[model samples]
Target: MTTQTQPIQAYSLPTPNGQKVHVMLEELGVPWVYHRIDIGKGEQFAPDFLAISPNNKIPAIVDPEGPGGEPISIFESGAILKYLGLKFGQLYPTDPRQQVKVDEWLFWQVGGFGPMLGQNNHFTLYAPEKIPYAIKRYGEETLRLFRVLNTQLEGRDYIAGDYSIADIASIGWAQSWERYGATRAEHPNVIAWIERLNARPAVARGLAFGKAS
Candidate 1:
C-alpha cells in the first residue's frame, strides 16, 4: 500500500465530478487535502491549474507519494478514482473479469450519463435563450440514460454486481435526477440505489462536502 506523510492535494469544487474523488478518498480512509478551484470564477483556466488539468476541469490531484515514491499530478475524475483504488487495494478488484465489469459501468457513466445530463442542464437552465429543440433533445436523452441505470439495478444492490467505483462514479450525478427532469416514480430502482449509497457515512459526508463552509 502507498504510504504518505503528506495528504494528496485535491484541486476541486463540489460539483458532481468533483464529488467522485471526494467520495473515493473518504471511503478509502485516506488522507487528502482539498484546494477549491472555483469554476464560477474561471479559476480552472489559470496556468497552474491548467498545467495538471489540460482540459481545464475542476477536479484534479497531486500525489506526493505516487509510484516510485515520486510526486505525480493527475487529472480526470475516473482516472483519479482508479489510481486511488489500485493504490489502496480496495474497491477496484484485481481479478481481470471482475475488474472488467467495474470498468464497463464506470465508463458508461462518464461517457453517456454524465455528458448527456450536463448538456440537458446547460440548455435547460443556463442557456441565455431557451431553444425548445435543444431542451427537448437533451431532456429526452437524460430520461433514457436514467432508465438504463434503473434497469441495471433491478435485482442488484449496486452497479457492476458490487459496491465499487462504479457506484462512486455515478452517485454524484444520480442524486441530481430531478434537476434533469427525472422522477423517482419512474426510477424506483435508481432511487433505492441512491438511498442505499447515501446511508453510508462516507457517501453522505462526501456528497455534502463544501456545502456547509
Candidate 2:
C-alpha cells in the first residue's frame, strides 16, 4: 500500500458494477487508493480476495477508520452504496419518506436490473452457445426492467429527486445494459440520463480508472 492518510481501501475492477463505488468516493471527495481485482482472469476467486469477499465479487471494500476505530469490510455492490450514502448522510436524503423513496429504487436495481441484465449478458453475449430459450428469456426480462426504469424516470432528473445512491446503483446497470446490445437511444429519457451522468468529471474519471473502460 502506497501509504495515504485516508480511511478507505477499495478492491475493485473498472466495470460499471465496480466503478459505482469509485464514483461514490470521488463524489464524496474522499481520498482512497484502489487495489484492482481483475475478475476477467478470475483474480476475484483467489484466496487473497476471497478473504474479504467469499462470494468472489468485484467492488468490495475495507475501511480501517470506520466507526469507533472498527475495521469494516463489506461486499454486495448495492449494500456498499447504501451504507456509504446513509452513513455519510450526503448522497441519500435525511427525510424519512424521501429516503424510503430512494431506498425503493436502489433496491429495485439490486433485485431487478443487475440480475436481469447480467443474465442478458450471459445469454446474449457470454454464453458458450446461445440457446433460443435462454436468449429470449433474458432478453425480454432485460427489456422489461429497462421499461420500468424509463417509466419511473419519466419526469425525474435523478432517481429520488436528486442524485443519490439510487442513481448510483441504477446507472451502473444501465451502462452495462447499453454495452450488452441495448441502445440508450431506444429510450430517450434514459439516453438523456446517461448523458447527464457522463457529464460528471468524477464519474468519467472513476469509470476511466479501469483501462478497459
Candidate 3:
C-alpha cells in the first residue's frame, strides 16, 4: 500500500519520547503522517500496534522508503532517531569521534536522564499515594541529572559536538524539568539550551504537533 510518495507513518503520542521522533522528522524536513496512539485509552495495546512496537510504547514508525526500498517498522525513540539520521545523512555525525560523542549523550539520555525524570514525574504527579521516600529519591536524582546536563552544556551550545540527535533526544525532557520538581535557576545552562532549541522553527513546530489536534 505504500507508494513512493507515501509519507512515513508515525504512530505516537505527544509525550517527551514521542516528541523525539516528531522533532527528528521535522528537523530532517521529511514527509510524515502521524497516527496518534492514545495511551490513556489503551490504544498502544492494540495487536497491530504491538506488532511494530512489542513494548506497547508510543513513537514507533513505519518507513515506506526503507533501506531496500521496502516498508520497515522501527520502535524505540533512540533507534528511530539513528535510523532517520542515517537515511537523511543529517543530524547524526559521520566522523568517528564526533559520532561517538553524540552516541554517548544520546544513550545517556535513553538510559539515565529520561528514565529518571520519568520516575520523578510518576512519583510526584501520577502516583496514587504520596510516598515520601519515592518523592525524595526521584527528586534528588532528577536534580542530579539536570546538574550533569547543565555542566555538559556549560560552554557548548548543544549536548554533543554539534546540533545532532543527542540534543533532539533530550530537548523535550529538559523542557519538562519544572514538572519534575526542578527549577530553571538550578540549571541555567539547561534553561538556555531549551530556549535555544525552542527558538528553532522546526523544533517549535515539532513540539506543537499533536497538541492542537
Measured on C-alpha atoms, candidate 3 has an lDDT of 0.90
Q: List, residue by residue over 120-211, the lDDT tens digit for candidate 2.
A: 88788788997999988888888877777777778998867888988877776777656555566667677788789889987777777766
Model 2: how far residue 34 lies from native, Å: 0.8
lDDT of 1: 0.91
Model 2's C-alpha root-mean-square deviation from the true structure amounts to 3.3
- How far in Å is the alpha carbon of 138 misplaced in model 1? 0.7
User: What TM-score should be assigned to candidate 2?
Assistant: 0.90
Candidate 2 error regions (>4 Å): 1-5, 176-186
Q: List the residue pairs that clash in candidate 3.
A: none
Listed in order, each prediction's TM-score against the native is: 0.96, 0.90, 0.95
Output the number of the TM-score-best candidate: 1
Q: Write the per-residue lDDT of candidate 1 for residues 29-133, one digit (tens) a residue.
A: 888999998887899999999999999996999999988889999999999989988988989999999999999999998898889888998999999999999
Ranking by lDDT: 1, 3, 2
Q: Model 3, range 70-153, lDDT digits (tens) per residue?
A: 899999999999988888889998899999999999999999999998988899889999999999999999889999999999
Candidate 2 colliding pairs: none
RMSD of each: 1.2, 3.3, 2.5
Model 1: residue 189 alpha-carbon error in angstroms: 0.8
